[model samples]
Every structure is written in structure tokens, then in C-alpha cells.
Target: MITVVGTGTGAPLPPDAEAAVAGAALVVGARRHLAAVRLPEGAERIVLGPLAPALDAIARYFDKADGTEETDGQQETYEEKETDGQRGGRVVVLASGDPGFFGIVRALAERFGSRRLDVRPGVSSVATAFARVGLPWDDAVVVSAHGRDLRTAVHVCRSRPKVAVLTGPGSGPAELGAALAHRSGARVLVVASALGDPAHERVERVTPGEAAARDWGTAVSVVLCLDESRVLAPVRTVAGPAAGPDRWALDEAEFAHRDSMISKFEVRALALARLGPRLGDLVWDVGAGSGSVAVECARFGAAVTAIEKTPDGCDRIRANAAAHGVEVRVVHGAAPTVLSDLEDPDAVFIGGGGRELPAIVTVCARRARRAVVVAMAALDRVPAVRDALDAAGFACDGVLLQSSRLAPLPGNVTRLAATNPVFLLWGVRPPARTEGVPQ
Candidate 1:
């Protein structure tokens, strides 16, 4: 059987796990793990560099471990080793705390079946960081930026009130801070570095700007981004992120819009369907009349930025966001010009851009990672917007949405009051490229 021991993070390895490492015929770990352990005399060691190489090395031992085949140039086979009063030759993979928790355990388990693995888990760095900060982590959203795009971490930080980001090279705290600095200044970042080490461990709280200004070395364990006011939430019965809003396409009366200028409920329903906003996604609502679309997107757990040329509209967006108990970054500037400063969105909703509709769609479509949904009144602008989306190489589809509401006339009689017709157009980047990777 292959034994996997989780170490590092300041905790001493358990006696059983240590003994497993000592008995390992072929030991595999990083430099630090190897240095910390006391290996049995003349045990084969593989210092991890590239993952495939290490897995290949481990496979060699497993192939011969059954004692059915000759050893890899070794004098004795596993049967002989076991008969000589030693445990049958087996592999031990050392990894950081809770290797199963977004660590090396997955690779090991995938390569060598779980049935073959005797896993001993240590406290994960995420747990250590949260413990250092003295907060309950059951409510925190944890994401790994290691070997993945930093944008996912950034968006999680933007959307959630609490988040723990596992830092990796190029996707570390500095990179995360720079991405969040301009957009989410209200958040406080708790930078936890070298956790579990008494001499070098640090848990410092800094603003996104302060974090961006520094060069944090490779010791970072995790970064906690929090909106302090909402960090302490009610006890969570269900773990991971909070659930998405139970209801969407909220009533128009729910939002504070300017003289019924918001995207009507019917238009919003289809627009939201096209924009598939969810956690870890960045969504833009350009020309957000009252940020109805933006607020709705935020309710679904997507990080939203509402761009409006009017200051009052910006305030309304913020107010609407606050009223809905969601966060929406409100940028008070016209689209097609102001969108340059904001980060690329996973999805975008164009509500009202007037003559700038085509230009706005063109800009948003090019940068949107997944889809772009546009809602318009003028029939003339639909062709231009479609052209722009087509130019951006999106698979464009649309519908003319016309709905009627129940109107109370006289004596409890009902009439179908036809709302103004709206053109709802959506452009989806083909599924092959829709997985949030920028083109």
C-alpha cells in the first residue's frame, strides 16, 4: 500500500505518519519535507519538481512492489523484504497540510488508486490561516489560485464577504491585491505568511493598495479578503459559499429606478438567463439605468460593476445594491469610454447606451469571457449591435420580447396591458472557449 502523509504548517507529523515515512522504500516529497524527516537507511528519494516525473518514479516502485516482477536493479524483492522482518516495499508521498485539501493528494490518489493509499492528513494552510486570524472558516469561501487564473480569486474576493485564497506563484497576494485594489478598496486583506512557523509566521491586515505595493515572497500561505462588517455571519448549516438568491428577475418595484427606465421584468428575465452570473464570475451592466440588472447579477453571487454616465444613476445603483443586500461596484461614467479601466467581465449586460450601443457592444463583446446580453428598444440599433457581436466572433442569437401585464381596470376586471417591445440579444463565445479563459 502507498502511504501519504500530510505535514508542514507548523504541526509535527504524527507518530504513525512518521513511522510510515521511515518505512517507505521509495519516499517522495519536496526538499523541505525530506530535510525535516529521518529516512530509513538507503531509502530511494525523489525530490518533487515536475509532477509527471515524480508520478512516473512512483509508478516504477508500484509496478515492482507486488514482488511478482524483479526489483528496479535492487537485490531483494518486496516478498524478500517482508520476509526479512521489514514492511513490504511501498511508496510514501509527502505533501503539505491536508494534501487532500487542494494539495498533492489528488494527484497521488488519481495515479495510485485510493484503495492503495493510507492517507494521514494534517491541518490545511487554509485552516491555519483562519485560525491565525481567529475566525470561524465554515462561512468563508476558499479558492485556490495556485496554477490557475488569478481572476477567479479576485472575483471571489469581490463577490463574497469572506474569502480565503491559496496563494501560488504569479497568483499570489501581490497579484491578487493589484487586481482588487482599484475595484474593491473597501475590502481588507489579511495576509498570512509562513503559517505554523513560530519565528516566521505572520498575519497582517492590509488594504488592497498596501498589499499591491509590496513584494511578498513565496512564503505566503493564504490571503483572507473580508468585508469586515459582514464577515461575522449567522451560523451556516450548509458549508462553502452562501446559496444563490432563491428568487431572481425581481419585480421592478423592488429596485429604485428613474421614471421606469430600468430594464423591464421580461427583458431582465431573458437578459439574466443569457448572462449566467454566478460566484467567481465578473459581470458588467453597462448603461445601467438604475442598475437593476447589476443588482440582480450581484444577488446571484457574481461580482458586478455598473457603468453609468450619470452620477445619480451611480448613486441609484449603489442604493439598489445596498437595498438588495448585495455589492455592486458603481462606476459613474459613460460606457465605451469608461469600460477600459474596469477588468474584463465573464458576462456583460448592455441595457441602454443610445448611439454608443454599437461601440459599447463591440468593446464588451471582445472582452467578455463567456457571454454578452444586450437589451434595447430601438429596432435600428439591433443590426449594428448584432454586427459588433458578430465581429467579436460570438455565436449571436436573439428574440423580440413583448409581454403584457395584468392591469386592473374597473370592477375587478383585468386587461392585458402590453409593455413596450424589447430586443434581447445574446452572444455566446463557443463552449470550447467559454470556460473563463481569456481569448
Candidate 2:
């Protein structure tokens, strides 16, 4: 039998839990974890460093009892059985904080199914750290930077203002502090360490720069309280493109393009409606001329990918993106072919395709979560796009946009100049399942 014990937040195991751990013949865990516990006088202790050797030790214990020779790759056993001599040995695994939440208990279960082990949990570091700051954890986003990539953590902090990051030695407050320091806007960083222990946990409130300067203690978790009232820049503060004329689907003259080519403001507005760019969504703009739609979508906090064939168009898109101060990854290549190697997008927008509309839309509809196709009076291709959408099981809709902007004529008099009519077709993939939640 394997007993999983939590030492609490830097505290000793409870009396009853200690008894169970002490009675076990073998104890296995990190060196620090093993050193902290007083083994029941003669209990055999295993110091865990790297994962492979530690797991091999656990497998050996089971092999000795079952009278079975150890086999490579067949290292796990679920149920405990009786031994020949009627003497049953017990093995106890130690973990920090709550065993189940981002702890070693999960690894144990995956290796030697849940039936063979009994878990005893304690206060998690996240809970202890939050309690130190007097913050409610229910609404907080909890993420770990311990032995994991910081990309998701950085993205979470960028999107959500309130977040708690569980940090380890190298991945501690200093690293996170540095990330937030360079990040635009105002934020209050809280570093809490050695929580719930007699060491007297320290909670420091500092500016991102100040926090980055200090060397944080080991086993720290950082809580970032974002100041939303703080604005990143003048244009960025404006929430969405639909809020005003200047906020989105910018005027064609704003970008440098060949032959006055653009997606047209009217068509862009419709594309935004169908694409629904938001946080956690990925939208691809294929045949992106000026990247106006892609940039606008990024403002709404969606990850955007713009595919353009011409080197000039790609450069123009990047320049426009930097001007707006939003991220829009521009890939310099032709679509349908170029897009095959790209990550699957949540939605796609097709801006230019002479005869490739059907094949492009078909491929996008297959890989994309949703797709929008824009056409400029290529009447023969409309039926093909519609048929492709139908075959891909998408609910399709379309609208024709014909805008006449009032312009000053050569006689210094204003006149409505009719632009070419464009066809906008959109298709949305239905959600797999939905449970109604009150808005």
C-alpha cells in the first residue's frame, strides 16, 4: 500500500498523518521532503532527485513483494496482494502542499493507479499565498510557472488583470517581475514567500521595476493586480472597432498599398462581425493587402495571422501593425498552400482569391473554427463558395456592400463617388454543445 502525505505549507505533517507515514517501511520523496520528516526510528528512506531513478525504486519495492522479476516498461502495479510470509510492507510518498493540485500525487496515480494509494492533502501554496495578501482566491486565475513554460502565464497576465502565479526557484518572482516591468501599463506586483511557516512569510508590494530588482526568496508565488484605469496608449484605450468610425476598419488612405487595393471599410466591418475576434481565439487573414482587418481584430485581443504573397504587402502589413501597436503575425507567402504548415486557426478571412476562392474556403472551413470570404463582383465564384460552405457543414450568410463616399470633385464641389460593390459571405461552425447560462 502507498500512502501519499502532504507536509502542509512548509509545516510538519499532522499527528495522525505522521503516524501513518512513520509506520511505513519505506518513504520516498524529494531530498528536502525526506530530510524534514523524522522517520519512525528504523524506516528505510529514499532520496528522490531525478524522476527515473525515483520511479525505479518504487517499482523495485513492488517487485520484491510479489515474487516477480522486474521487467522494463512494465513498471506499474495497481492492486496490492498478500505476500508469502504474511508480512505486508507499506510505502509512503511525501508531497508539498495539497497532493492533488499540481503536486506529485498526480504522477503517482498515473504511474500506479489511484487504487493503490491513499492521499492526505494540506493547504496549497496558492491558498496560503493569497491568504497572506488578504485576497479572495475564487475569482483569481491560478497558474504555475514551476517546471512549466511561462508563455501561457505571460499571456494570462496580459489578458486578465488579476492572476496568481505559483513560482519555484528559477521561475520565481524576479522572473515574473521582469516580465511585468517591460509590459506596458501600470500594475501592482505582490510577492509572497514561505507562506504558513514559522519562517514568517514575506509579502512585498512593489512596482514592477522595483520587484525585478530584488532577489526573491525560493518557493514564491506572485500575484499581479492590474490597474485597468491605466491606459497603454491613446489609440489602444479605445475598446473595440465598432465603438466609433476611427477605431476600426480604417480609411483606405491610412495604409500604403499598390493600385489603391484594400478590403474596403464596409466589407471589413462585416468581416469583423462574422469573425468575432476575442481573447483565446486565433483568426487568420488570408491574402491580406494592408492588414487593416487583422490589426483591428488584434485590438479586440485575438491572436491574428495574416498571409500575404507580395513582399511589399507583408512589409506594409507589419508597418501598419507596429503603427497601431498591436501584434499581428504576418506570413509572407501565398495561402491554401502556405496555410497548410500554419497552426489551425479558430476563424479565417479570405480577402483576395481570383479562382482559388472555392479551394481556399474549403480548406479553411475544414481546419478553421469559422470562415468569412470576401469577393469583388466575381459573380461566377459565388455559387462555388456557397457550395463549399454547405459541404463543410457551416451555417452560411452573405451581404452585398455598396458604399458611396462623398468626395471633393475637380470643380471643388463635393459628390458621392460610388465604389465597386463587394460580396461578403460568412460561415460559422456550430458549437459542439452548449449549456445555457444566464447573461
Candidate 3:
């Protein structure tokens, strides 16, 4: 049997794990984990560097002992010969914290099978980090930057109030801090390094600017990024991020806009519905006039980027976002040009694209993973935007919104005031079809 063991942050191994390690004929783990455990004298030790070779060795060892015929001769050279006294060899795979949580057991299970793995989970780094900080983690979002892009982790830090980032070599506290240095809101980055190893263990709290300036060597286990202002949330039945905002489609008066340039509340509500912004989603607001849409999207827990050409518009967007207590990245540049540099988004909202509506729609629809919502005052640009979405393989749908709000008259009475009409165009990417799934 292949036993997957989790070594908790610098703690003694359990009796069962100790027994397993002592009896293991082949022990495989990282250099640190290998050095920590006492392996059987006769067992072959494999220090994990490039995992493919070690996995191949493990498969060969297990297959040979199980009396399985080797069809491929690849593993024959590395196969360990059994001694006269030994019967069947036992394999032990050591992992940090929980092997099942973004750990090596997944690779092992995929190569072998779940039935073969006997997982012994220990405390996760996220749990340990939160414990070190004296904070409750039930409301926190946990993301791993190990062998993956750091952009998602960065975005989570921007949107979520509390997040635990599992750091890798290149994507540690410094990288994360650098990304958030220019972002709005006050954040406290708790860098927890070398957990469980007292000599190497250190937990330091730093600002985004401070974190960006320093080079924290390769010992960092995890970084807890938190908006210190909103760390403790109100008691709730649900955990993690709250279930979106209570009310969306906020009034136009709520935002700071120039000459009523913002999209009306009626139009914004429909656009938000189509955009479907949520946690872990990145949204782009191209030609953000007053950033009303961007602010609203951010309120829904989506990381938003508002791109506007005018300096005043950019400032207004930032102001509006700050006023609403949400984070919206204001990019002071024109679309189609600045759009290239930004990360690909899950959704895109086009507020004012001018002559470049088609080009902006093309770029957004091309990069957007889910949907694109566009708000336009001119009816002439509707066909072109719809055509652009269609060309990019998006199923297009649109509606013209015209609303009348109640206004106080000179007398002690109210009158219906009609707002300018806007066409709300949205395109949803069709879900990928599975081979055996029914239509």
C-alpha cells in the first residue's frame, strides 16, 4: 500500500506514521521532509526534485512487488532487486501539511488510483498561518500560487477582505506586495515562513509597499493578505465571502459623474445581471466614464479594472470606488491599446467605446472567459457590436432600457422624469460540450 503522510508544521510524527516510515522499503519526499524523518536502514531514499523520475521509480517498485508484468521496459533499469529475506516492499510518500490539499497525493492518485492511496492529513499551512495571526479563517479565501499564475492570487487580495496565499519560489510575499502596491485600500500582509521549524520560523506583518521592497528568501510557506479595516466581519450563518450585495443597480446619484455620463441604474442592473461578477472573477470596464459599472461590479466581489483615457475620469472612477468601499483598479489609458497589457478577464463591461466599440468588443470577447456586457447610448453602434460578438463565437442578446424616475415637482407632488434610452448588449460564451454528455 502507498501511504501518503502529512507532517504538520514542525511537529512530531504520529505513532502510525512513525511506524509506517520505519517499515517503508522506499521513502519519497522533499529534502526537508526526508531530513526530518528517520527512514528504515534498508529503504531507498528518493529526494523529490523533478517528480516524474521519482514517480516512475515508485510505480516500478510497487508493480514489481505486486507481481505485475512490465509491458514497457522504461522502469526496468531503476527497479530495486528484492533481498532474500524481504517479502513485499511498502512505499511511503511524505508531504507537508495535508497531502490531499494542493499536495503530491493528487499526482500520485492520478498516476495510480485513489484506492491505492491511504492519506494521513495534518494541519494545512493556511490553518497554521491564521492561528499565528490570531484570526478566524472561516471567512478567508485560500489560493495557491504554486505551479500556477500569481495573477489570480493578486486579484483575490484586491477583492476579498481576507486571503491566505500559498507561496512558491517566484510568487511569494514580495511579488504579491508589488502587485498591490498601487492598489487602493489598506492591506496587511502577514508573511509566515518556515512554519513548524522554530529556528527558521518567522511571521512578519508588512504593508504592500514594504513587502514589495524586500527580498524574502525561498523559505516562505504562505502569505496572509488581509484588508485590516474589514478583517472581522459581522456574525453570519454563512462563511467565506458574503452572498453578494443586498441591493444592486445603485442610483446614479450615488456616483460622482460629469454631466450625467454614468449609466442609469436601470441599465446598470441589467448589465450587472449579464456580467455575473463573483469571487475569483476579473472584470474589465472599458471606457469607464464615471466608473459606476466598475464600482458596482467590485461590490459583487469581482476584481475590476476601469480603463479610461481622461485623467479626470480615472480620478472620478477611483473616487467612486472608494466612496462605495470597494476596490476598482483605475487604468488611465484608452482601450484596445491599454487592454493588451491587462490580464484576461472572466467578464467585460463596455460603457463608452466611441469609434473603437467594435475593436474593444473584439478584444474583450476574445479574452473574456464567460460573458461581455455593453452599454451604449447610440442605436447606430448596436449592429456592429452584435456582429463583433458573433464573430468571436459569443451568443449575443440585447435590450433597450428606458426608465422614468419619480421627481419632486414645484407643488407638493411627484412627476415621472424620463431618462435617455440605452441599448444593453450582452454575449454569453457557450459551455464546452463533454463527449458523452447529453445536449
lDDT of each: 0.88, 0.73, 0.88
Question: What are the runs in model 2 whose C-alpha is more than 4 Å off?
Answer: 8-12, 71-87, 221-439
Residue 125 alpha-carbon offset, candidate 1, angstroms: 0.6
lDDT of 2 by residue, 1-439 (tens): 6888887476668887787776777888777678777877666778877767877788777776665644685655445544322335678888778888888877888888989888988888777776776655565567677888664565455444456777766777677767656543456777776566576667777877887888776656445444444323244333322232247777777766678788888788778888887754677889898888888787776767789999999999989877876667778887789888776777888888677878888888898865655555677888899889889988888977889999897888999999998888888886665568533
Cα lDDT tens digits for candidate 3, 79-181:
4555433545678999999888889988999999999888888888888899998999888888899878898898889998899999998899999999888
What are the TM-scores, per candidate, against the unseen true structure? 0.94, 0.56, 0.80
Candidate 1 local Cα displacement, residue 380, angstroms: 1.5
Q: What's the C-alpha lDDT at position 354 in model 1?
A: 90
Clashing pairs in 2: none
Off by over 4 Å in 3: 71-89, 250-261, 308-324, 331-344, 353-371, 384-397, 402-420, 427-439
Q: Give the runs in model 1 whose Cα sits over 4 Å from its true position.
A: 67-80, 83-88, 432-439
In Å, residue 168's CA in model 1 sits off its true spot by 1.0
